[model samples]
Target: MNRYESMMNHLLVQFSNTKVLQAIFCAISDELQLLDDTFNNLKEKRWIDTGEGAQLDGIGEIVDRNRLINNAITINFFGFENQINTTGFNQARFREYSEPYLSSTSLSDEEYRLILWAKVNKNNSLCYMNDTIKSIQFIFKTDIAIVQDIYNAKFIVGIGRKLTKNEILFANALDLIVRPAGVSCQSMTHFDKDNVFGFYNQKFAKGFGQAPLSEIFSNNLIKKGYVV
Candidate 1:
């Protein structure tokens, strides 16, 4: 028998008058199953939301051995628009859902939260911000074990609101006012002379890609705030 069944059998033998407890355990199991179903549905829908940006219009495979290593919620689903190389992802950090990769990395709490909200939603095409990716990402792995949602919770400085499971994906590219509604959100794609200059002159004056994002100068302008 499985672990749960074995445990229940042991409990029954240990305590003769424990029918109520067994019933309660059974009910708890049912509730947990329901929660599992709901979580799966939500995750699938979210993955679908990334369809517009993913390289493949349809994702299908037989072996499906390769894992999409991503920390950026949007990048996880959509991939990159112009570069198309996988921005917003750290490979090493993707070890949980993905097979281990030496080059992959993880994100800071604030960074992860911001990227999550910026993702496209099935209900609303608009992106915002949130902390839902970790739990949603882990739904597939939690069938046999209870996966804990571990994340450093933080706020979007733009809205000063705590993030929930559903929200938008923030794009550093959103600051590029030149691009139209959709393309502008692809920060890894566009180039805004003014924004780039500003980011360079003030934030990373040492030259671009010199320092870690957290080490950069601007908190409000770069990470949290919504700029035009």
Candidate 2:
């Protein structure tokens, strides 16, 4: 999730009454727009397209370096950085152990622990979680464990946004799957049917719950009578 997405989701969790939350949502949305110049959700459109038949399937599509013409372009989103909450982290963790402590074998585990975290003023129906959500006037409770290396680690935790199309392209080009912390599947609604896209469908069976995002693309590109 982007910072704004996180904020919106957290807002949903915070308030029960829908009507009251709308005002707050609007205010935040307005403020975010004001910050768009410096910290934007999408890149600036500064390039003029060439009149030639330069073509790319999508805005972020990779072009053939040797192609006679290509219309590939890059977008940059100046997103906000995650703000670490040391106090909130401490409160969330079990205070009994000063250092990170978990009773597991030598085998390291990085399960659904990579799950995103959010703040709630009171305990509502959720999943495996931290201690409290009402203490801090500001700041959210996000997983910070993904970046840490703990002996006999039981879970993985991360706090970051999902990969954009351009980012996925860069990672796929290198044949390297960016980890959960760095990138995740884009939402299905954002995808075009035949474009190469990544998704995280939880179909776990083996000892691993951490499934890398999968890609789909070009399956129907050469249908019998399709455009040649």
Candidate 3:
């Protein structure tokens, strides 16, 4: 039963059937429901996944303090020398590569939440190689490869085609933001069989002259998305 019915049920026996008292209790019950809804909304504001609007922004303040935007921006006040423009001869047009970049404005509610959640996991949880793999799986729920090159002090993240533009940007920046400092990160498209160099007993292993040369810099970097 709703609040109105529950309130009427508890009344003293003599007052239970009174129409005047029943009307007053019904009005009070409606007001109490509005408070219940507002209270629940306040409770949801504590989490990034459930918060909306100002509540979401409040959560962002704690997790994403820097408010890093999905896309990187480069600005140049002066025009570049010797740049050709087919559309027009305007130097201003040639110098400006894209529209002025706005921070934290281009992303949607879900995209913003994704960024915040990733940072939240990174700040609160383990961040080793395996942890990074698990974090990617939990945050993205897609096929991603994390290749570690300890000798070179670098790791590469291979993102598949399922991510959004903002997601791709966040994935590219994940290393610098989440991983230990001094480790370089390179994010790129997923490596296909043709782009990966192979070794003996490997998924894409090839003989000396049996297959074409691959463009990947190292054999350890590619092997069907496994950590090597």
Candidate 4:
């Protein structure tokens, strides 16, 4: 067997080790049989690669495995065996579903979010900045002042708003905006003269900026605002 196949076999063993199937259904239960059928079907498909760098192939295999697991969970635990439907199976797939789409060279969500949030908030210079707040929150360590500064400066007004020194330091530490070495600025405006914001805007703005904040920032600020 190739490396991918070996990995799939390992995963299959891990799934069975959970013993979730046995716990959820009697040995001869129809649900158990369904689970067995799903598992054996996956094994028979020989879709998994037992080698390194087999992420793409593994995704399909892992997804099939999770599907079987979820089916077993839903039927035996949730007592939804009668409602065995495949309509929403996609959501239960593993995180590896996105592995193929990612690149080793790509900046992490944290890095991308920091860059986009800094640019949008700086360029628009608009209060009531409803978007990209979550990106800011996720990229930076959770600091209430930093969040409030970005929010109140652009979202809410007449609220006696200012970013604390610590918050400014934190934002600066992200280095989302490139600046000359040893230069210091408390706010984004200091870098505006050289179009520093524009520089970052051009580099990190595409794809990263456009991605859904929920995916990029771990919070759905837009949905929370009813922006849809």
**How high is the lDDT of residue 45 in model 4?**
44
Give the Cα error of residue 78 in candidate 1, in Å.
Answer: 30
Cα lDDT, model 1, residue 115: 32
Sorting all predicted structures by lDDT, with the top scorer first, yields 3, 4, 1, 2
lDDT over C-alpha atoms for residue 87 of model 3: 32
lDDT for 219 (candidate 1): 20
Q: Write the per-residue lDDT of candidate 3 for residues 98-201, one digit (tens) a residue.
A: 54421233456676777777777788865577766666666666554555554566666553224443343344334323565566564344444543445877
- Is candidate 1 or 2 superior in TM-score? 1
TM-score each candidate. 0.17, 0.16, 0.63, 0.18
Question: How do the residues 45-86 of candidate 4 rate in per-residue lDDT, one tens digit apiece?
Answer: 443322222332344344321111110111111112222221
lDDT of 2 at 111: 12
- Model 3 lDDT at residue 124: 80
**How many Å off is the CA of 164 in candidate 3?**
5.8
Tens digits of per-residue lDDT for model 1, 60-80 = 121121123232232222223
Cα RMSD for candidate 3? 8.0
Clashing pairs in 2: none
Question: Regarding TM-score, does 3 or 4 come out ahead?
Answer: 3
Measured by TM-score, how close is model 2 to the native structure?
Answer: 0.16
What TM-score does model 1 achieve against the real structure?
0.17
Name the top TM-score candidate: 3
lDDT string for model 2 (39-133, tens) is 44234431113111222122112221221111111222222222111234324433343432111111111111111011122223232233211
